[model samples]
Every structure is written in structure tokens, then in C-alpha cells.
Target: MKKLTSWALIRQNLSRKPVRTGILAVIVFLFSFTLYCGTVIGQGLSQGTRTTAERLGADALFVPYGYDAKVQSSLLRGEPSSFYMDRRFSEEVRQEKGVEKVTAQLFIATLKASCCTLPVQLIGIDPETDFVVRPWMASAIDRPMRDDEVVVGSKIVGQVGDTLTLFGKELTIAARLEPTGMGFDTSVFLEIDRARRLLLASELGPRLNLPAGLDRNAFVSSTLIKAAPATDIKELVNRISQKYAAAYNLDFVVVAGMITDMAAKLSFFSRCIHVFSGVLWVLGALVMALVFSALIRERKKEFAVLRIIGASRSALGRIVMREALLVSLSGAFAGVAAAMLVTTLFNAYIGAVLDAPSLEPGPLYRLAAAAGALLLGLMTGPLACLPAMRKLGRIDAYIIMREEL
Candidate 1:
């Protein structure tokens, strides 16, 4: 007969009690699955919030009065909307103290655009004055966008060189930007001059009911402001409110303030997930301990026979620990694999359910999280079996056999 090595003995032990081994493995699986999912979601929310702050690239946004929420929805949720205000307000903001730069964007919504099944947002920006979108666009396009060309967000349906039709005019796709996990992902960007021309020529222009003959250069949806270094943003906001609040009917969306609020909410939600995962881990460990203790009693006679056949106390203890290690490793690998698959497949659904911008974590982050979960999973088996190992070490072959008789 082949030699019954330690590993072979472990395999025999596990195979003999397949149902019991399966139960122990399942407990560890549940713990690892919850931990991995929680870690991914927490990391995603934090990354998304950081990316949003960077992408905003403005100290404050100025939009038509009572449209602050609409602007927020469009920016954060990829919702399409159209609105306009006098572009003169943007020029005036540029002259304010503490204002380093001001760039205007025109918002237009296209209904059933050729590029998408649903409406899409069209943003017109001036490359010369734009600080927000242009910096991000550099990664996608090497040169400035022409009046008839457009750069699209990652989530937009078409590829570079594809043509998109909007409001009866055709535009070429100059480039496609990387995903930022923000509303811009579904938007089309073009020169402000072209956007102004499209709006003027389209039927939507008359619907605005502007104050008699507002020139194309006079239309703007919003203005993004960059403050001078070390400038007090609050004071700048107060000054703008006092100067243009009444005259231009302007509302402010402080980029920093929005990010701060989002971070706080994300932090709270992350904490809840962690706390719940911790509880599940503790419960899993306790249940494993109980099942292992019971397993020790049932295997007493079998272990006594091994001791009688010349197996030392230390050898018996090793057998139990090796079994535990094998089972734990098997379950841990399965759990982590399942978690990663589910998260990747339903990532968009998760973001919608959480009602927040969420970026998938990078590969390094994912690898680290998997390592942590596997470590915990590996520890669970060893820790739960420590007491059982101690009990097996003190077993008396003669007494155990007599009792069995």
C-alpha cells in the first residue's frame, strides 16, 4: 500500500466527513464574501468623490437663478437639460476681484439624438478660456476641437471619426474621453461658438422667450470660475451674490462645498458597511468554533486508534490544523472570486442604488483587498481549531479506546 503521508491523512479525514467539512467551509465563505464586497464599495465611493472634485476643476459654478439643483443633477447624474442666461453675466464675473479666470458653457439637450436612444447633453466650451473640460480633454485629443467637431465622454455610444447629428446639423467625433464616473461621461463637448449657432438656428431658441433679440454671443447656460491662489472663496461668493444676484438672477454652486457634503455622506455609508461586515466575521468565527469542538468529540475514537498505531501527540495536532487550512483556503478562493465577478458585472446598478458617483477601484486596490480577505479567511480556520488541537494533544489512547468499548 502507498505510504499514508500527513497530507494524505488530511485528505482522508476531510473526505470521511464531507458534510461537516462543507459546513465549516461555508461559514468562512460568507465572511470573506461580505468583507470583499464591502471593501470594494467603500473604495469605489471614495475614488468617485475624489475624481468628481478633480474633474469639476472650478472654485464655483454660476448658473441661472433657481437652477442650482438642475445643474447638480446634470453634472452628477448624467441627466440632460437645457437652459440659458445672458452671456454678459459671464463677462462680468471675469472682472470681479479674486477671480482668476471665467469660462462659460452652453447647455443644450438633444432629443433622441442619432448617437443615443435617449436625450443627450450638449456642452459648448471656449477652448481659450476653458479650464475645466480642456485639461481633461488633452488626454483624449491632441489638438483643439474645431467648430464642426466634438469630443465625447467615455459612456457616449460612438467612436472617434463617427458622425453625430444634433438639431439637424452633423458633427464629427474628434475623440472620446476616459471615464470619470460623472455626468460628463454621457455628454458631448464642442466649441461654444458652434453650440451658440446650433441653438440659434434650432426651434429651441424661440422657446426661451429671451428679452428681444438677444444675440448668439449673449447666450450662456453657466459660468465656471477659478479663484486666485489664497483667495477666500466665501468672500468671493458673497461679493458675486451682492453684485450679480439681483441683476443677473444668478445662483452659485460651490464645487468645494458639494464635494465636502458628498464625502461626509459616503464616509457614513462606508462605516455602516464595515461595521456590518465586522459583525458577520465575528459570527462566522464563533460558528466555526462550535462546529469544530463538536467534531473533536466525534473523532475521539479515530484519533485514539492513530495514537495507538504510534502517531505522536504533535502529529495528531498537525493533522487537525492541516485539515483546517485546506478547507479554509478552498472556501476563501471561491468567495473572493464570486465577489469580484458580481461587483464587476453589476457596478452600474450598485452606483444607482447608492445614489452616488462611484468609480471602480484600480487593479492594485483590488489586489490588496483580495489579499486582506484571504488573510482573514486563512486565519479563521487556524484560530477556530486552536482549542480543538489542544484537546487532541491530551488524548489518552487507552482511556479513549476503553470508553469506546
Candidate 2:
């Protein structure tokens, strides 16, 4: 009987002011939408960062002695830098016990001849053996680089077949690879031989003067190694560093450290996003609390009448809370649905705009958002009723009747 009475009372309150109820519903919908959109965006950014990291498959990276800072700057912030290492070190590293595969790359910092506005990171790799990063890249573009051909990053404005003049020589763009949201997206990749020729053509080329007939391809900027599963990756890195230090008489920096550092930076950004989302959620709760509190105050007399008719204070409080919970849950649900729909519709466009991988919100994210909303609603319900409940407690049946007279 109490349950039925509560339901009837709820229906009566809702019907009494249909216009006000409709307005409150709209407010709830808007609040929910804000919460849902913030959560989806935060989840998308976190996923995108992790995906980029996973795609870069190198267990450890080997670079020149002092170029560690340069390498990290390039990877994280798209800064232009160069490094150099002897090709002999590549061969020796491959001969190590736990080394599975070793690949060397030459990176050149050069300006485009046609449009020399910004610097470009030109990468030179042996097409035959370079399979670690974006293994499917070769197949995706079909034709491989020849003597004077190059593959451009997806963000490269030039199209396939267009001639891009670097260091005064023109090279054809054979293909374009997908964007990785890293410095690579702004880079151009070509055969080691071609890149060497372009580097030597510059005025600063004399600084790196080579032997009269030495093969330019015999030297590289860095080597990337994939160690055996049984091998400790860090141990392998330390061993390789020592070996390269003794053999080449040059500094050897680990690329894996740079990757780990990048991961840490990404994690920091994720936390910042989480905090911002949390703040927005709190603001939404506060708004709901104010709206509910005002509604309760206006319904004081109605609550008093219920109290007069043998309704327990606990029962009146439950009804008030039930109304708040219903409104909050409905709003939250509507907001989340709208956010998902918006995310789905614009995900591709957002990925392109950000020049990062597409954002993917997993199942865990949805479950957490739902749970958070429920807890928030429950907490806000009681707080919103405090003032009205106090007023109801003080009202006597005779006093209310006298006021009514």
C-alpha cells in the first residue's frame, strides 16, 4: 500500500506542472550529454596513444652517442634532427647471441628544394630487411623504392607520381603510408643510397667527406634490434651499448628508452584529461543538486500534507529522492547515447584532424561511465533534499491547516 501511494504521489507531482517537468527533463538531458561527450573524448585520446606505441614494434633502439635528446624531441614534438652511426656496428650487433634481427636506418635533416619553408625528416632504410615498423606498409603501397624513388608519409601534401625536390635533386613519390601520429608522419622515406647522394649534395656535405670510393650505404644513422624472447631486453640493450661503445669508439643510445619516455608523457596527458573530465562531472552534479533543491522547496506544502496523513518522514524523503534519481538517471542515459552517436559519426574526421590514430572506446569505458553516473546521482539525491526535508520535519498538521485557512 505504501509503495502504491508513493507511485500515485509521484504521478500527481509530475502532472501538476507538466511545463516545469518538461523543462527539468531538458536540463537533465543536456547535463548527461556533457558528461558523456567528455568521457568518450578522454577514452578516445588514451586509446589512440597506446595504439601508436604498440605499432612501433622495436624492442630496443640504437642511436648515436649524443643524439638521444634529438631523437626524443623528433619523436615527441616533430623536431628536425640527425644522427650517424657506423654500419659495422650494425653487423656486430646482429652477431650478438640474443639478437634476432637488426635493421639500420639513416636519417637526414633536409629542406625541400621546391618549398623550403619547414624542415623534413628524411629516413633512409634498406627496403628488403626493414620489416619492424609498419610491416604492412610495403604491401599497402605496392611498388617499392628504386634508385630515385621515395615513399611519403600520409600527411605529406604531395601525391604519388609528384616530384619532390630535396637537397636540389628531384625524387618521385612512389607511395604514401598511413599516419602514425608520430614524427614519421612528417618524414620522407627513401633508399639509403639515394638519401646519401642528397646529403652529400648540400654545402655542409664536405664536413662528412667520405673515402674516394667507399659505398655510402655502408654507414647508417642508427640500428634497431629485436632480441630473442628468452633474452632480457634491458640486459641485451646494456650489452649492445657496451659492445658498440668499445667497437665503434662512439656513443650508443638506446631507442627503447625514448619510446618508454614517450609512453610516460602520454600517460601524463591521459591523467590530465581524466582530471578535467572529473571536474566537469562534479560541476554537472552541483547543477543537478541546485535544481532539485529548488524543486523540493517549492513542493514543501505538498510534502507537509503527506506528513500530516500518517506518512513517515522516511517515506517522504524516499519520494523526494526517487524523483531526483529518476531525473538524473534519465538525463545521464540520454547524454551518453548522444555522445556515442556523435563520436561514431565524427571519429574518422577527428583522427584526420589530430593526425593521430582513430580513437576507440572499449567496453570497460562504457561500464565505468554507467557506474559513475549512478553513484553521482545517488549522492546528489540526498544532498538536494536536506533543506526541504528539514522544513517538512518542522511543520505541524495544525499549523499547515491554519495557514491553509
Candidate 3:
């Protein structure tokens, strides 16, 4: 019976001050917006970081000796870079246990005349098992590489049947691949033989004739190894390095380790985001407290009348808290809906600007936001009602009525 009476009294008080209630509702809306923004940004960062790590598929990467910095910069920072490794290391690594597959790739820098003289990275890989890197690279133009043909990245902006002149040699663009937001987006891929031919030609200052039945491509630039399990891969890499210590001077690089480091850095940034969002939530709660306190002060006379009419101190406090809660819930729902709509609408443009893939908000994110807003709202209500509760408790109802009459 008391709870029913208190609810009825809350409705009466709210109806008496529609404008105050509306103002409190607006404050709650603003608080919810702040929380939504903070949560969405943190989620986007985490998604972007994970996407980047997944795209670089390999438990371990093997690069040339003394080129760790160069390889890391090129792969992680999207810089145009190159390195070299002897072909002997590829054979030695293949013989090691736990090695599933070994592929050699060559990365060379070329000045393409068609793309406005931009320096582009040219990568050469065997198409047979290169699906690891070019998994999504469909033939958007002529076809996959034939002899003396090259495929360009989607960003190259060359149409089908266009010739790209690189190092004074004209090669037909066989195909173009979809953009991956990495250095590969601006690169060109060709068969290993063609890449070696181009590199040798550039070095010799002329098209060098290959000796009959002899391929001059004695060494590959780098080796990519696919191994089973993290521990096994690490052990295999170590064994290969130890066995060929004197015979091969090539460096064995672990792409997984680099990616793990990147993940750690990303996690650190996500934590920072969480802390920032927490601060915003606190600020919103404080604002709400002030707004509710002001509203309670304005309704003091009404509260006193209720107290005189047999309303207990607790009942009066419940009335104020109920109003605050109603405002917060309505406002929070509205704000979260708005934030989700806005994020969905501009997600494509935002992803482009951030140089990352589009982010889809997960269920966990929405649930957390809803629960957080409610708790904050509930906490703010009591904080706001404290002053009103104290004033009503100390008031002399007989004197208030006598003075008013």
C-alpha cells in the first residue's frame, strides 16, 4: 500500500513540474550519448587491430639477415621496402621437422611510369600456394599472370589491357586485386621468374641473356614458412638456424611474434580508451546529480505537503528517485539508439579515413552500455534525493501548514 501511494505521489509531482522533468530527461540523454561514443570508439580500435593481425597470416616469417627493422617497418608500417635471402635457407628450412610448407617470395621496388612515377613495391610469388596472401585477389581484369605478365593492386587505377612501364620494360597488366589496406594495396605481383629477370636487367643496365638451360635466379629474396603449432614452429626455426649456422647467413624472422607485439600495443590502447570512457561516465553521473538536486529543491513545497498528508520520509524520497529514474531510462534509450544509427550510417566513411575495415558493433557492447547507463542513473537518483530527503525529514509539518494558511 505504501509503495502504491508513493508511485501515485511521484506521478502527481512529475505532472506539476513538466518542464523540470523534461530538463532532467535531457541531461540523461546527454550522459548516455557520452557513454555511447566512448564505447563505440574502443570497440572500433579493437576490431581494427585484430583485422590487421589476421591479414598477415603466418605463424612465423623468415626474412634475410640484418633486415629485421626493414621487414618490420615495411609489413607493419606500410612502407616500400626490400630484402634478400639465399635460396639455400629455403631448402634447409624445408628439411626441418614441423614445417608444413615453404614458399619463397621476392620483394623489389620499381618505379612505375603509368601510375605517375610513384615508387611501388613489386612482389613475386608462386601462384600455386600463394593463396595465403592473395586469398581474395580475384581476377578483376584480364587474367592471372602468364609469362611476362603482372597483376596490380586495385589502387593502381589501371584498366584492362593497359601496359605499365617499369624500369624501361613494358609489361601488360594481367589483373588487379582488391585493396587490403596494407602496402599490398599499392604493389604489383608477378611470377618469380619475371621478377628475377627484371631485377637482373636493372642491375646489368641491359636485358641480360640467360645462359641456355640455366636460370640465373640462384637465390630468393625471402622464405615464407607455414609450420604446425606455435611451439613446434619456434623449435623448427631454431633447429634450422643451428644446423645451417655457418652455411647460411640468412635471418629467420617470426611474423607471429611481430603480430603478437602489435596485438599487445593495441590492447594497451583499448585499455586507455576504457579508462577515458569511465571518466566520461563519472562526469555524466555528476551532471545528473546536480540536475536532480535542483529539481528536488524546486519541489520542496509539494514534498512538504505530501509529508504532512501522512507520506513517510522514505515515501517522499522514493517519489523524487522514481522521477529521476524515469528520466534517465528514457534518455539513455534514446541516446543509445541515436548513437547506433549514426555509427552505422557513417561507418564506411569512418573506416576509410581510419585506413581500417568497417566495424560491426557486437552484442556485448550494447548490453554493457545499457546496463552501465541504468546503474549510473540509479546511483544519480539517490544522490540527487539526499538533500530533499534531509530537508523533508527535518520539516515541522504543523508549522508549514499553519504558516501557509
Could you give candidate 1's per-residue lDDT for residues 1-405 as a string of tens digits? 899699998998898889988988887887788888889988887887789889988999998888898887788767888877878888888888899999999888888799999799999998889999999999889898887899998889997999999888899999999888778988999999898888778787667566444565678889999999999998999899898988887899998988888889888888988898789778877887777777888889989999999999988888888888888988888888888987778765676677667788988999999999888987888888888888898889899999877
Candidate 3 C-alpha lDDT tens digits along 1-405: 456565676677677778866766666666666566556755664564565456656556677567766665555434566666666576667777787777777777664456645677778876665644555555464445677677886567687678887766788887777645455666787887678777887754344443233335755666777886655767777877677645656566776676566566656655766676577556655665666666656666666788878888787767766776766677667776776676657644554454443344566876686577556644554565566556656666667667667
On a 0 to 1 TM-score scale, where does candidate 1 land against the true structure? 0.91
List TM-scores for all candidates, in order.
Answer: 0.91, 0.65, 0.61
Clashing pairs in 2: 33-335, 61-255, 65-251
Model 1 steric clash pairs: none
Best by the TM-score measure? 1
Question: How much lDDT does candidate 1 score?
Answer: 0.85
In candidate 1, stretches whose alpha carbon ends up further than 4 angstroms from where it belongs are 1-5, 15-19, 200-217
Instruction: Give the clash count for each candidate.
Output: 0, 3, 2
Q: Order the candidates by lDDT, highest first — what do you get? A: 1, 2, 3
Tens-place lDDT per residue, model 2, 110-133, is: 754452367888888777668554
Residue 297: error of model 2 in Å?
A: 2.2
Model 2, stretches more than 4 Å misplaced? 1-49, 112-117, 207-218, 246-272, 298-405
Question: Model 2, clash count?
Answer: 3
